[model samples]
Target: MKRRKRKRYVSTDIRKSENGATFLSILITFVIVMITLPLLVYLLTYVQPVKHNNELSVNQFFIFLRNDVLTSEQVYTDDDNKMYFLLPTDEVAHIEQYQNVIRRQVNGRGHEIYLRDIDSFTLQPISFGTQVTIVTKEGREYEKKIAHYE
Candidate 1:
């Protein structure tokens, strides 16, 4: 009877080298990560925050304006393009562009800044309400139509 010989499989040196990541591959991966990390951090920390803050501020301004208009007894824009809201308590809220900022005055007193870095602010009387358009110094345009309660 002939006996069958079992063949032993041995891993070569080349096979061992290819089994895991080499020094060159690890170094290249580290270099790629180092190159991309700073750019990602810069975009997340610097580039996005400024624009995001600007937009957030503008939105908050709009919300405040809308709330003031909706809760007021009357809303009107004067010949000088300044907006006025007559509240239920007989208090007048005046909103106008003062230099490079939009300010709010209560009964023609106090300086309350609503928005800053403004290039232009316009209030156009629409059929249903007023269309407020603001142009920022950075060339950004934002418009919102706030409706009157009555």
Candidate 2:
């Protein structure tokens, strides 16, 4: 019987040198930081509570205006710093007197009042609560409760 000698196995090197590995790690880290920096800045600046008021106001304005019950004629900010919603009405007598400003009249129950001559309204953030009011062309007013934004 002839005996055969076994060959020694050697491990092949797949990894780069220590310095090259360190450089590659640093490059990867820098790329990740650059990609995330702008997103972080944007979220910190634009998506903060500091913009809550403006965001709520703009959303409220659009929502109330788009109600199907009301017809929008004109939307303008008045000298009194109040935003006004202009509406047209001919159903009720003396409604023409309040062509621009909304008119309120006490109901028969006296607990609530009806309003007319308003196109739409936004609920300004008030300490009391979130209240939305709207008016139709037929001189009808509708009020609704809304969720308040923090």
lDDT of 2 by residue, 87-106 (tens): 44422111111444433222
Native-to-model Cα distance after best TM-score fit, residue 89 in candidate 2, in Å: 15
Clashes of 1: 0
Instruction: Return the clash pairs for model 2, or none.
Output: none
Q: In order, what lDDT does every prediction score?
A: 0.89, 0.44
> Model 1 over residues 1-150: C-alpha lDDT tens digits?
999987676654554345778899999999999999999988877554334766787899999999888888888899897999898999999999999999999999999999999999999989999999999888889999888778
For candidate 2, the 10 contiguous residues with the lowest summed lDDT are 104-113
Off by over 4 Å in 1: 1-50
What C-alpha lDDT, on a 0 to 100 scale, does residue 98 get in candidate 2?
A: 40
